[model samples]
Target: MIPAINIDAALAALTDHWSPKVVARVNDQYVKVAKLKGEFVWHRHDDEDELFQVVRGRLRLQFEDGGETVLEPGELCVIPRGVMHRPVAEEECAILLVETVTTKHTGDVETPRSRSIAEQLA
Candidate 1:
């Protein structure tokens, strides 16, 4: 049975930056919690839109077209599929990510920060 999943507890269990842990699943998407800081590589999923919810601190989503969006607690944003973007957090930030189960953490450009679905599930 899927028990009640606590976001705070789920976030607290995370110990790495840019690494997402699967906390729940709704239909074809995976609900994940991650601790983030610094800057992530610029990449885009070819066919999956990615959702980010700011749970703590702040997040800056930078786009390839020189645009950006800052997210505060309780704020969420969705990056449409195929949009090149990168995530940066000046300080440690906690966030919830919702995306298809097949979505790669860093899209096609694999970096040291990339986390596989199997790794996320573990």
Candidate 2:
């Protein structure tokens, strides 16, 4: 049976900055939420594409190729596998991330700034 998803209930569970809260799963994918501020690390997933949806804030995704896109509330974007991208925000914002179970939030590039994918899944 498919689990019911209550957006309000899910959003209520999130209470940290940049820490993702997993709320739903579809196949090998997870629907995750987090509060973003400042900047994230540049990373890439070799085998999974990622989707980013802004729920209550704005975010800017910077690509290694020197291009970037700002995702406003209600807008979303997909980041392809093996591409380097970093998420940045000017202030506190809510965001939902969708990706395969194997996809890392920080991709292959690890740094102190990288939020552990496992931790987020929990």
Candidate 3:
């Protein structure tokens, strides 16, 4: 039987930045939550689109083309596949991520901040 998942509680369980926790799976996608504060690496997924939904505070998605989008609570934006993006949070922020099950945390770029699927599910 599937149990109810609490976004807040799952978010509270996360203690790292840029590390996303897999909370649920729907079809071919994974639902994840993360806490952001500072800047993430600029990377792009060659085969999948990613969605970021702000749960609290704010987030800024910067693109390689110098374009940027600021997201407030309840706001969401989809970063098209293969587009380079760097996520930034001036202050502490909580967010939900929706992406394909095979999507990497930092796209094709690997940093110290990257977390594996096993780690996220654990």
Candidate 4:
């Protein structure tokens, strides 16, 4: 049986800015939290969808066609696989990510800014 966990407590343990400290896991998927700012690399996942939620501050997702959506705190969006999108933050923003085990944070756009960690906890 899996033990209960306090996500708020786990979120507090993270200190490194922009790094997603794994908070928990749901089966083969990982739940992570991170602080983001400025423009991020454009990328796409060929297999799995990417879930993004703005827990605080504001975030914008830019698509290849130049379309975008701004997500304020409490808003969430899921970018389907193979869709090119870039995450942008006007200021320090807290975000929650739900992704599969093998999903790369930046997907196909490999970059130095990708959040690193083997997997998260539950």
> lDDT of all predictions, in order shown?
0.96, 0.84, 0.94, 0.81
Model 1, 1-122: lDDT tens digits are: 85799999999988889999999999999999999999999999999999999999999999999999999999999999999999999999999999999999999898887889999999
**TM-score for model 2?**
0.88
Q: What overall lDDT, based on C-alpha atoms, would model 4 receive against the true structure?
A: 0.81
Candidate 4, run of 10 with poorest lDDT: 113-122
Worst 10 residues of 2 by lDDT: 109-118
Ranking by TM-score: 1, 3, 2, 4
Backbone clashes in model 4 = 1
Cα deviation at 68, candidate 1, in Å, is 0.1
- Would you estimate the TM-scores of all the predictions? 0.97, 0.88, 0.97, 0.86
**lDDT for position 85 in model 1:** 98
Tens digits of per-residue lDDT for model 2 on 3-111?
6887767777877777787888888898898888888777888999999999887899999999999999999999988888889999988888898987766778766
55: Cα error in model 3, Å: 0.3
CA lDDT of 35 in candidate 1?
92
Worst 10 residues of 1 by lDDT: 108-117
